[model samples]
Target: MTASTSTVARTATPRGSILKQRVRWGLDHALPRTVMSYAARKGDLPGRLIVESGNVETADLVDLFDAARADGPLHRGRFSFTTASQVTVKEILTSPDFRTGIVRAGGPLAGLREWADIDILGPLSAPSLLVTEPPDHTRYRKLVTRVFTVRAVEQLRGRTEQIANDLLDKLDPSSPVDLVENYCARLPLTVITEILGVEASDQERVLTFGTAAAPSLDLGLSWHTFVGVEAALQDFDAWLTDHMDHLRAHPGDNLMSKLVAATEDGVGLNDAELKATAGLVLAAGFETTVNLLGNAIALFDKHPDQLARLRAEPGLWSNAVDEVLRIDPPVLLTGRMAVRDTTVAGMRVPEGAIVSTLLAGANRDPEVFTDPNAFDVARPNAAEHMSFSAGRHYCLGASLARMEGEVGLRVLYDRFPGLALQPGAERRPTRILRGYDKLPARLS
Candidate 1:
């Protein structure tokens, strides 16, 4: 049972595994889609947004948000209650009546949670900070919050600068290069691996695992895609077992090692807790930041005026990062399930009702951001966006990501002021997460 002995990369996934994934999709995704699509037909923004196929464009999103806004801040949908108002989003996210989780307890699809079980740890599952509440969430956050605090990120800034510099230094930017492969992905990859005590040799393996498994964040994935993701999760789960065992025996001065040894009130994280925490940290540590970097690069290429402003006042780099997150966030939306009957924004949200908040829509709420559709790096209140989610579940790596985004973008531009972006940038396929998968560019 201990895949603790297996290598990171295994042989081809068996044919039966595809069948297994198909069944998972049927229960986990298709079932949800049926509800969502039904809701979509009856005027549900969140439902339509997820099930609608084809290339997602900014224009299409604007229409959805406008419709949701017209329908008012809080309205009931078959899948969940949907909201487009920024204020409602803030309220729903910060409310005590709501709780952290994807599936609502005793809700129509609650059975799917039990059916969704897998051997590998998923970020959205239990024992992870993402899904647990209060005491457990508080305890888990306490253990790692110190390392990601603003002050802690400030301490890590020097090393981050060096990491960014080294990544860009190796870029042969002479001809066309995929910035994602060359620079954007590597900077965060190096920094996160160093924190986790993983060696250079294992970073790419980690990246592959994360890349393949990233779609696990989105629902309603095609059977084939879901199968591939499961394979990666299985491989990653096996690798983590071996790595945690290694770290325990030969502890290093890194988060994973510290996690292995540190105890909370005389009790340390159990194996499930340890793997879930470590794996979530490992994937999250790099994945979104990779999106942030790539998204920023593409945005800058499109808005040289913003770059000009940043160049004029390099001090604005930090706020500029916020601007990028606001306009083109790395994550699109998040849902919160109600634990008790509570009225939000004058609407009665009963127990077990799921509140779907369109974070990207909230960011673009005209009432909150002036010229909401326009990309303005110096929009005085640019940092007000809820791209990081709000309250307890706010991204633990927010400070780290902000620092990385600022450092990565600033270093790349300063190093190559004449950087020219090539045509044909493509966004990632996952609906919940947003960012570029490939960005072709040239640095002169």
Candidate 2:
């Protein structure tokens, strides 16, 4: 479908259709216990997210990316509330001039403060590593590195593999299972919580908060999601603060304890940064990793030959992980702003303009990768994909995420060699973050 046609159809969706969609969304999207119980008792669904979810679909993502690439390496567009100029090339993503520190006080995001609950822009709230630019960004990132170093994450591999296997082992072999909820979602969530030293009793509560807060990142949020997000954020902040406080007094080997012990330039993270950083680590740690596992399985189900190839060469599991990531990245799009009038992929970007770096598009750039559309597990250059992003703002948990993906997919395929997609698997209605909400599968 044409872009105009897709836009018109999306804008013209009827209220009844939207209501039904929201109902289905509620069932599919995880919610905190408080919200779920309230929803059940009050018969009030989570408020509808009013923002326009992006138009791209999993099947059509590559084409859309290709079109954006054809528009030039830098294509200007408006995505919901922000004027987005998407950069669809590797060169731009790696450029040092483009930065995440664009959203400032009195900027477009700050103007939406009254709509803060629903606006859900991270920079509008506080300075975390994700939204801040240099100096502050440098400071926060340095302190974060002290906790999430490559060696630190590599140390989690054994436990990550164990978590993946444990979740897979619990699945019933005789019946169709929702790989997302049963396996994919549980693994990363468990691992992250374990890493953070969340009490076993409170882990479920944290997951609920994480689920409630997720919709805020969608760019388009309904009043329902806003309310849920506001409540969840407040509660989650408090929960994290309490946890950090405990870690401060009673240190352990967990990451939170390390964060508490960490200092940069002889300065420890203050109260606010401590809470914000902890929240970011917890939320991001599982969100994309869950999608990575789900998307990998979904893609493998689509290309049995690739799956067979990986199964035959067990050593290729790591390469397969990268291929799956390149094929269907969990985090599809991220934004950077030209710090000054800068040239990205030869396009002049004005200072303060938001460039929505299409990592999904960059991954499939035909100019960069051979047969970019094909899902080839052995593709040598697959690791070059921008799925984990590039440059200074690269994902801090990337190594950990990669380990989880490789181990998770390997264990799943090994445990259920005859696994096949069961009918009725459904993709989540999201563009920025793509993954299966329900990947039904029969483990033979």
Candidate 3:
């Protein structure tokens, strides 16, 4: 067997390990929610936000965020601090004083990491780029970041446009359709899977796994959601193992194939590291873009004036994409740990404090944008939004997502200019990853 296969083989989940994973998930759900809920009872904003992150009425989040902003960006709670100020959010994200991946450096759950790692490949896990800090993250990123660069994503733009056109061709403008399923999901799925060298047949399985596992990024998951997500993640990990094996044997021109031979200096990523990197790239590449497309369509349907501006002058399409991201970002929030005691937004944060930065709230901060709550496609500073996040942990797929959003939305409206959003649009229940799961639209 090859080195890649051998490395992957050793990481397989033992049946005993699966049960341990279940216990970890349960502890994860129970402990935090218990603490957060107790704090919420005493009117702690940070705790309230955690407890209600998955609320269907997202306006509650908006209200809580507004309160946070009014509370001056950093609200110290029983366990953590919450911030909705753009300045503080940027400082926390950009500063080396903060880190991701740990539950808390010196908190109660720090030991859980070494105890319960049991072969689960979560985005928040050590090997994945979302949580890993420098040196390691820098290494993984240096090798994998090339394919998603602006130039590289620009290379894919024409192909994405063609894909958009092809997807549009299948839609009939005379009747109602669910754009989320028919267009929003398929466009990115096709593009990213092809980029990763995944066959067309496995795209749906990728989608199923992505849908089931998207919640892995959210905090305080219930037992049912946690188990289901972990199970789906396992299946995805298995598929990735076989896919990596195939790529090693018959390397193609795609990114996955490049990663198969990827190295820095003389050392290459091991199988577990490779699998973690590829898995995140594949899942995150399409999942968030699906949300971006759906969010843009829903936003455009709600604001015809902005959509009309794009219709009259197509130059605004690129900015329009950023505008959509600004107003209704696909991701709602992210958290960071203070590596050492630090001051943020004129407030004190002790070491190990979990700082919850509300990206949606920061995007709408009045201190940053005039009439921040309004949706304006031509807003000059729309590109400043933290929708792709900020600093070293900034989104890897931002360029691709932007390109896909512009091409996909423009292609749809260009194909059927009079498209109208129907009622009953449903938001995906996952908190961290926000977007519509179903958006019914009339093509005529």
Candidate 4:
């Protein structure tokens, strides 16, 4: 199907029933215990279920991150009203419905227009290639195949390592440091910016804009946060347009240049599409990796023995990263709109229903993983973790993210043999991305 046809079809689809189901499910599965019980007694389904239940709010990215940090895999009240709307879709993604791809047919975003503000031009509209069935997914995957090839990512390993080391060099062990601000945040930002051929001065600006842009998918124009987001999008569009123009005139050896050179059946990414793709790559490539690194460090600190094991057997770094991601994926939920009626985990979901898979929950499902709560670097099936997700929509930067984690950890341990968490470092009050806002440690 052509993009124009898909766009027209998506807009024309009726979503009243799907919206009702979403509201119903939000109330049923997302409400606080007392509130839900009260509603149950009153027989008011909608009344019983709160739109932003404090218990299952994973709605806000920050709250979701905090909840994951405080409570391992599945935690109730992870999202407060303030945060739920943002992460509601992600919460659903972690649920069992996602694994079956039934939700993908008619995912949540389709029905969420009433609840959230989503940009139709974004990946949300890109047929659930990540979660959809094989043939279509395979075809879509092929289109972008060159972008995420293992060799494509591996080519940047040397540069990634250099970026990691450079960030580490800036660490001042004397004073309390927010690892997220300094290293965790900086490493991926630098790497991704480099990949996009963004200049050093523009790295932080681009990242700030990218981060703001991500939450805009749900926060919309009403949320104060989105004010910055809108501005960021405008800024990013301008920046990318200029950058792509430059690359068009003066091609170089970079991802942006390659993308500019790439063509599909003699059709290439137009200016707007190029900007969107660049924005997506910048946001995902940086923000998620920052969270992943921070979470990994926090987990290592929490499990000294596991850290010790890794220190002894550096090879375990790969499995260790996987285990950490399984326990606390950087991205908690991914959204999809159901294209048709589907049943998941015995729940009869109607067509156009918003399907959310809680990836963290799915990763921790006892049926799928043994001792799901434990942080075992040696778990034989650690690589089987769905932190990067499975199927078509899998993260394109999985390899690069892993390389950064492995190299970062290896360097961290080697440098600070006696690194220990500071006496008190408060975590940031967000849930969607798990990591310490300030991780102060003494690096001896």
Q: Pick the candidate with the highest lDDT.
A: 3
lDDT of 1 by residue, 1-444 (tens): 210000011112232444555655686667777888787788676788776622475435878877878878886776578787999999998888987654323544444433443222234222477766787788888776744568856777899889888887777868888898878889998888887888889998999998998877777667787678768877887787788788888998776777777776887777767777777788777788998998889888889999999999999999999999998888877888887899988888988777778888899999999999998888899999989999888888888899889888888899999998889888788777778788988898
Residue-level lDDT tens digits of model 4 in 57-78: 2223333333433433322231
lDDT of 3 by residue, 123-218 (tens): 422257776678778887887775456887888989999999998889887878999999999999999898888998999999998888777777
RMSD of 4: 8.6
Displacement of residue 311 (Cα, Å) in model 1 is 0.8
> What TM-scores do the predictions have?
0.90, 0.81, 0.91, 0.72
Worst window of 10 by summed lDDT in candidate 3:
1-10
Where model 4 places Cα greater than 4 Å from the true spot, the runs are 1-119, 123-141, 217-222, 423-430
Tell me the lDDT of candidate 2: 0.67
Query: What does the lDDT read for residue 47 in candidate 1?
Result: 85
Clashing pairs in 2: 47-224, 48-222, 49-221, 49-222, 50-221, 50-222, 51-220
Per TM-score, the best of the predicted structures is 3
Residue 299 error, candidate 2, Å:
0.8
- What TM-score does model 1 achieve against the real structure? 0.90
